[model samples]
Target: MSNGNETAKGMGRRRGPMGGRGMTPGEKPKDLKGAIGKLASYIRHFKFAIVIVAVFAACSTVFSVIGPKILGKATTALSEGLMAKIRGTGGIDFTYIGKILLFVLGLYLLSALFSFVQGWIMTGVTQKICYQLRKEISEKINRMPMKYFESRTYGEVLSRITNDVDTLGQGLNQSITTIITSVATLIGVFIMMLSISPLMTLIALVILPVSAGLISFVVKKSQKYFKNQQEYLGHINGQVEEIYGGHLVIKAFNREQDTIEEFDATNQKLYESAWKSQFLSGMMQPIMMFVGNLGYAAVALSGGLLAIRGTITIGDIQAFIQYVKSFTQPIQQIAQVINQVQSMAAASERVFEFLNEEEEDQSVENPCDISKVTGAVSFEHVHFGYQPDQTIIHDFSVNVAPGQKIAIVGPTGAGKTTMVKLLMRFYDVNSGAICLDGHDVRSFNRRDLREAFGMVLQDTWLFQGTIMENIRYGRLDATDEEVIAAAKAAHADHFIRTLPGGYQMELNEDASNVSQGQKQLLTIARAILADNKILILDEATSSVDTRTEVAIQKAMDHLMKGRTSFVIAHRLSTIRDADMILVMKDGDIVEQGRHEELLKKQGFYANLYNSQFEETVA
Candidate 1:
């Protein structure tokens, strides 16, 4: 992570767990119950199927719970029949024993069949839930305003879609089944044990509180670590994503060692929390088993004494012992299920938080059709800022006549791009309104408002595709001939034709196969193909060499002939021929004039223009 105080503050600002900020998600959101309720809303669509699954699950657990008791009957019959044969004239009742064994087998098979059906239905239910969640999240991403994404890392956002949703789905599936089955089994086993012998049941129940206490202790201790594990995992993911994306920068600046150390620190933190949570949660089974053994011993001793006193039959004693053993499993499962639910809740909170972010205010009460809008645009006394207390653009105003070439020039943080963003309504002005052809920009549907203007930004974004396809992105319905013509207009056709496959040549990811200048040319071609009445060129020629820049400038001149154009440039020379120049400083226009007039005034624009010449002379 960078040590800049602003960056540090951003990383430390609390949002929630997986918030890409600090450690926790502030507070637990109503704990497990709240998460379960939210998840239930998604699950309600499959209620009929879930209900059937619950029915089958209950039936299966009932069968399983009784199987051991029935098998004990067979054991008793065999032992009694053998004793009869050894004692005197009678032989074993083989037929009766066979019948008991067959009944036990049938019960087990039915249990297995019902369990399979339950699982089969649950698989579909869980997958559909995940599908719906992911679909909604995908749509939500599109509707989310720029501010939401700006506040978080890309990895954090992606993790909500991938990791958090998966966790919710998987946890819901297991927790639902486990809760139903475990509770049913625990109830059935307890009833069977009490029927066999209340004394033995009481003896077995002795371990319940101790086991519960142990489980509660482990869960409470482990949950904090689990939460920490999740936070650290997100931190590590964010760090890794940032580092990998800037691998080139790291190498160039020879900051590889610093990057690695930072990654290792975050990785080490993740490892600690991950293992600690795992180790604590993992101890549950053994501790429960030990308590189970103690219960088993108590049951054995009490049942033996009862059998010797002829108070209970051998078969009943055998069934009671099996119940004692089976009883602990469900309790253990229930404990683990609780843990699973807690983890699920943590994940659900993050996922739901993202889904509920404030979307773009897209309401246009009286929408205007922008299809035939004139190219004239005006900003009147605009006051805006990304945050409430820190206004960046104040009392800003501008008016451009149709077909005028207006150049905005200023220092780096002079609200240049902010002005462009306001013009496009990427961010609405806090007070004033931007108008297009005498209509407030916000009065038009956002999509309609954006269609009248085409933009080529400083960053040249070309996805992995054929050169022709990339250019055609501006107007997806454009024909190949139109694409080629647009390329020619941008002075990109000559170089593109020189490639092995001409226009069909495939660009790699990041478009690293072409030089930065060529990438800029392709973007220009895209804008040309768009053929909108208004155009924005934000340092459109910055990447190209002087020769290419001159050619591109000529092409842009032709493109902007009858269109309203806004050119934001740091290189003062390029905008010298603009129809009007608006010189800005600290969000306000300090000077607005033609090139010759601004030079004669000897104001900020003159000094800014002369600085370039002085630097070249030096």
Candidate 2:
């Protein structure tokens, strides 16, 4: 739950309103071309669909662009007929005007139909791409090395799957159609305006640079504010999640006022940046409109002069003005599309980065069969470190015959649990080998190697399911009676039955409804149900009360019979009856012997045991 803050922050960084208009500008891809190239490769299979969408978009824009010119014909006829009637030479042509109006309406309906088809196809393509990316990312997570997860926050990884992929999807859906339609509209509208009057078309062309300059200026001014807003939003999100998760701790320490102050500070910054960005972005439309009006006024003035001189018809002037308005709109749409492309590139890069991370080798060339392994384990000069340059377990060596109860006793940071991890191959040793039944652990497939052993750690893990289901997780094919038998063996059956629904009782996520001791007991039952040839218990009894611990120790002794068991215990009293006690310090075993003999030697183990005895006496 402590990781909730990191997840919130990651989400906030990429969070924005849909359609790419208000996306945060905080992140940009380092290699824009490369990211786009990779994204292009992903959609190459859908190229045919994209081509269809582009054709539809062009058709839609072309029909829309031709509407004004066709409409102008009707206007010309009506005006000429009215003038003729005033001079008593002719009358209005309502029939011709009606035909022109109906034709224009058909064009518009076709345009809308084309637009819908393109939009629908583009949406399907975008969703498919997003789905594929998410699927690959999910598969990648399982194959990724543990070190990668340990080095980064879970939220950061999750954001690549959720936020980054979603941003990429939305950007693709909007940007592709937008770029196609906007460009088509620009070309078609320009051609229409030129046909009406090159002089008015030229006058409209001058407005492009002015409108572009204003848009550029606004984008430049608003970008920094957008970045600040995104940064502060992430900060606020992280702070809120962190404080909420630990509110009880804050309350216990009487730090509510401090938390409030911190939250206020972040909220204030978010408000400041958010308003500034919104204000600047909001100014763009009005600014463009102002520049557009200047162009419109100039065109209208020029068209009227040409009209009076009979250089162009009144209908031409009307159509040219409409074309001029249509022309500036595509330019604005193109500018927004550019922003969307940039955002898309940034998001795709993040998702690709995660997808390309190094994956663990989950298989071997010819895996050894461990099904019949008798668990004769040995570590021969094994060496390892989470980081290669800083070795933790140095020159470790040990051997255990089948069916030995081996207790590992040490202070914290003495590589006790590390030894168990090595045996299980959670991490492979940097040098030498850990072997079972004279075969190196690496010789077997990771799954086969792991299936031979069962583990019960100090931290019990139970998912959101019924108690019966959680216990059944140990051996998925086990029967309900076998599950109950295992639970009885671990002494968990009594408390489980006392619960509201007994075996059917559901545990919430984290299993907070149960006491710490109960959770530990449930895990023990799970391990017992697994009934592997090798068992590793790392402080498995540390959570239980004194009497429960005694009962559990007896259960453990019974379960460990005729199996290779490695027990790591901080409480020296718990492992006194073990067949062998190996005392470790600073990643090396300092001593090893039966408990009584080790105490008689008056060495490190004896001193540790004496300290606990003194504490008990006091």
User: TM-score per candidate, in order?
Assistant: 0.91, 0.86
Every candidate's lDDT: 0.82, 0.81
Per-residue lDDT over 384-403 for candidate 2, one digit per residue giving the tens place of the 0 to 100 score:
99888999998999899999
Q: Taking the tens digit of each residue's C-alpha lDDT, what string does model 1 give over 247-333?
A: 787788888888788778778877887788788878988999999999999889989999999898888888888888789989889
Query: How does residue 475 of candidate 1 score in lDDT?
Result: 88
- Where model 1 places Cα greater than 4 Å from the true spot, the runs are 1-20, 24-33, 88-99
Q: Model 2, 293: alpha-carbon shift in Å?
A: 3.6
